[model samples]
Target: MMISRLSAIATAPMRNGLSSASMTSAYAELHCHSNYSFLEGASHPDELVARARDLEMPALAITDRNGFYGAVKFFGAAQRAGIQPIVGTELTIDDGTTPPKDRVDYDRWGERLLLLVEDKLGYTSLCRLISMAQMPNAKGVARLPADQLAPLSGHLTALVADPKERLPFYQEIFGRDRVFIELHDHLAPDDRSRNQRLLELAGRYAAPLVITNEVFYATPDRHKLHDVLTAIRHRTTLDEAQRYLHPNAEHYLKSGAELRRVFDRYPRDIV
Candidate 1:
C-alpha cells in the first residue's frame, strides 16, 4: 500500500476542468499552513511536501497567513516530488474598521480566507496583497482590508472562509463563480458552527463548495507539538492555554476513503 501510494504521487497528472480525469482519483490538498503561519504552526515546507509525497497527493496548496516565507521552498519541493504547487495565503480581514491585536477577538472577521493567483500575474498579485497586509505593523498580524483584497479578485482562486469574513465583499465584486465557500471540520464545536455558516452562505451566494483540511500538522500524533507551537506563539504556557488547543488532531493528510467518509454528507468528491 505504501509503495503504491508513493507511485501515485510520483505520477499524478494535472487537470484544468478536463473531463478525462476520473472522479475516483483526487490527490490534492488546499489549505495547508506551514511554519510560515508565524510561530503557530508546526510543519515546515519540506515537512509538508514529504507528508504529501507519503500520502500520494498529486498537488498541494500552501496558504499560510500573513506571508509567503516558504513559497519558493514549497514550489521547489513540489516540483521535485512531481506534484503541482498552488501558492496562496489565508488573510485576516478587518471588516469592522478596527483590527484586533488579540487573536481571540480577531477570530471572526480577521482570520478568514482569500486565496488568489492565476499564472505569474496571479502570483505577483498575491505577493502584493501580502505586502500590503503586513505594511501596517500595528494591524495585529496578517490582517488586510477589503479594498486591499479587491485587486486580488478574479486574478486567482478565492476560497471564501468559514467565518465568511470577506465573502460579502468578494461576492460583490467577483460574483460567486470566482469565490469558493470552503468547508472545514476540526471535530470542534466552533469549527462545526463556522463550517455550517459557511455552507449556508454558499447557498445564499451561489458559490461552489470547496472542502479543505486547514492543516497544520501531518497527523493526530503531532497534536502535542502543535500545542507547544501555539503556546509559544501566544506567549502562554502549553497546559495553561486550553482554549487554543485543537479539540481533535485529525488535521493531518487523510486518505481518499477517509475524506469520503468525512464529507459524504455533501454531494460529489471534494478536495
Candidate 2:
C-alpha cells in the first residue's frame, strides 16, 4: 500500500499539497530525521510515520542530514498513513569558519540550514546542490559553501537554525517570504535566550517564525538509543558522551497539542 501510494504520487504532476506552506495541519514536523541520518537518527522512517499517524499529524517532513536518503521510505510510509510527505534536507553550509576543536560531531564542518522543496523545480535543484556538496568533499563530510546557495535558491524555502548571523543572509537569498527563522526549544537552559534572539533577528527582516522540535526519534523511549547513536557518531562511550549527548529526551516527534503547549508563548508560530 505504501509503495503503491508513493508511486502514484510520484507519477502525478501536481504537488497536491506537499509544499511547506500548504501544510495546514495544526503542527507540521518540519525538521525531522530517520535512521537514514546514519549514527544520529534513532528511528526508522516507518516508525516516525507511525508516530505521526498516532499523533494525528497531517504532514511530516524527513529532512535527513545532508541528503534524502530515506525520502522514498518516508514518502511511502506517510502516504500509507494518509499524511503528506514534505521532502527536504538539513544541509550543512560551509561558512569558512572553523568550529571549536572540542566539538566532535555537531557543527564541526559548517552551519546547518533546512531547505524544503516547494515544487518539482526545487527537487531538481536540491538534487544538484546535494551532489555538488557531496562530490567535492570526503565521503561522509558533506558541506556546501554559503556562496553556492543563491543560484539554487529558486523554488525552495529556507529555514535558518543556530548561529543567527547567517539568518539575514538566507533571508536575502531566499527572499523575506521564502525564508523562515526556525525556533527550536528543547528545554535547554539557553533555549529561551536563544529563541528570543532568533525572534529579534527575524523581526529585523520581517521574516516569519516557525516552530520545529528537531525530532531525531519517534518516541521518548528511543532517546536511550539516540544517546548510543550520538556516542557512536562521536566515537566515544556513553559515559564520555556527557556534554555531547542531548540534555533531555525532548528531541522526539511531538503531537500538535504538545507542540502548542511547548510554544504557547508564540501561539502564532505553532504551524
Candidate 3:
C-alpha cells in the first residue's frame, strides 16, 4: 500500500493551468501544503514550486500543518525555480484542555491559524512556536493553546484560516496590520456563508482580507488522490471517509485570472 501510494504521488499529472495564456499572474498563493503535511498533502515541495513558477506567481507560501518539516526543501526548490518562498505553518490551536477521547472529539477541539515568516525574527519565532506545540508529546498530534500565541506575534503575520469565532483571539495577538482574514471558495456548501462572515469580521476589525486556495494538490485531477490521502490520514477507507473529504475538486492551485474571477466580489482583497 505504501509503495503504490508513493508511486501514484510520484506520477500524479501536473496541471497546465499555470501555462494557460489567459492566466494573469496577479495573486500569490499564501496558504498551501506539501507532502510534509503527511497524508493530507498529495504533492512534493518541488512539484508545488515548479507549478507556481509555471503560473508566474511572484511568491508562494508553503504553510504545512504543525511543523517546518519541509521548509528547507521547499526553500531550496523555490530558489532554484526563481519563486519567492514564504515560510509559514498551519498551526492547530486548542482550548488548552485534556486530549480529546476520540477522533470526533479531537476534530472538534482545534482551529487552524496560518503564520507566515516576514523576516529572520519571524522565522525564529515560528520555529519556537512549532517547538512549543510539538515538544510536550511526541505523538503526531501537537497543538498550542490560543492564549499562548500572543507572545510570538512580533514579526510574523497571521491569517485566520476559514475565519469563524476565533477572529478576536488572533486579532488581539497579531493586531490589525499583522493579521489577515483568509477567504476561499472550494465549492463547499458553507463557503458563501463563511466568506460572508469573514468579510464582516475583517470590516469590524479593520483588518485586511486575503485570498488563499488552501491548496493540497497541484491540479483538479489530483483531487481523487487527495481524497485517498485524506482517508489514509483518518485511518479509514474511501467509502467511509465522507466526513473527512472535501466537497469538490476545486482546491487545486489556480491561475491569477481564475483567482480574480472567484474573488471578484472582493476586488480590494485580491490586491
Candidate 4:
C-alpha cells in the first residue's frame, strides 16, 4: 500500500543521511599554488596542508608553478595529516623556457598550464614537467614549451592556466575528454569575466571544469604580508603596482562550503 503524508517525508528525509555523506565525501581543492611558486607566495606546503586538515578536507593538490622543489615536503605533510595528496605541477610552459630574445616562439610564457596527477603515471609525468622546467633552458625561469608538454599530456591531466594561450589549440588537438578549463576566484575584479571565458572554453572542448583558490597563504589575514613579499620581489612599492596585478590580498585557502556557493548551480557530481 502506498500512502503519502507530510510526516513520512520529514520523518526520514535522508535515510540516515548516508547517501548524502557518501556523495559529498568532503569536497577537496585539487588545484592550489603554493610557496614553491617563488617569492610571490608566503606560506609553505606544510602550512597549506595543515590548513586543509583544519578544515577537514579529505584531499588536496599542490600545483606549484614550474617547480617540484617542495613535492616531497608537500607529500609528507599531507600524508601526515591524513589527507590524500594529489601530486601536481603548475607548468610554466609558455614562459621561463622560451626567451624574448629568441623572437620566434617566445610568445608563450604569458600563458601558464596547471597539471594535476590522476594516478601514478600522472604523477610521474608531472615530475617530468617539473624536472624539465627546472633544468637548463634558453630561458631563465625554468619553463617548458608545447612540444615537450604535448607528449606528457597522456600521463597527466592538464588545466590551461590563467591567461592560458594554448587553450584554443588544445581543444582542437586533445579533444574535450582529457582537458579541464579551470575557473579560479580569489576576488580579482575580472574574475567573473575570466571564469566565463574559461567555462566557455570548457564547453568548446567538451572538457570538465575545476575551480581552485590558487592559495598563496592560508587565511585572509596573511594576505597583506604576501602582498609585501611581492613588492619585495619586484623591488617596487605597493603604491606603484596595479592593484591585483601581482598579489591582491584576496588569495587564501577557502572551504568547500565557500567553493560550493560559487558553483552552486553545478552539482558536486558534475564538478
Best by lDDT: 2
Best by TM-score: 2
Residue 200, model 1: Cα distance from true site in angstroms: 2.7
**Model 4 agreement with the true structure over 177-243: per-residue lDDT tens digits:** 4565666666556676776776665556555555566777877787777777666555578776444
Ranking by lDDT: 2, 3, 1, 4
lDDT of 2: 0.76
Total clashing pairs for each candidate:
2, 0, 0, 3
Per-residue lDDT of candidate 1, residues 1-271 (tens digit): 0112211333222222111232234646777888877765678888888888877777777878867778889889988987777777787666555554574343334556657455676777777877877787554465677776666655566776554455676777666555666666666667656766665666576666656677887667777888888777666897776787777787876654455566554434222
Clashing pairs in 4: 94-108, 94-109, 95-109
- Candidate 3 lDDT tens digits, 204-233: 767665667899988888889889988876
Model 3 scores a C-alpha lDDT of: 0.73
List the candidates' TM-scores in order: 0.81, 0.86, 0.84, 0.76
Pairing residues by index, what is the TM-score of model 4?
Answer: 0.76
1 or 4: which has the higher lDDT?
Answer: 1
- Check candidate 2 and list the clashing pairs: none
What's the residue-level lDDT of 203 in candidate 4? 57
Please report how far candidate 3 places residue 33 from its true position, in Å: 0.5
Determine which window of 10 residues in candidate 1 has minimal summed lDDT.
11-20
Candidate 4 achieves a global lDDT of 0.61
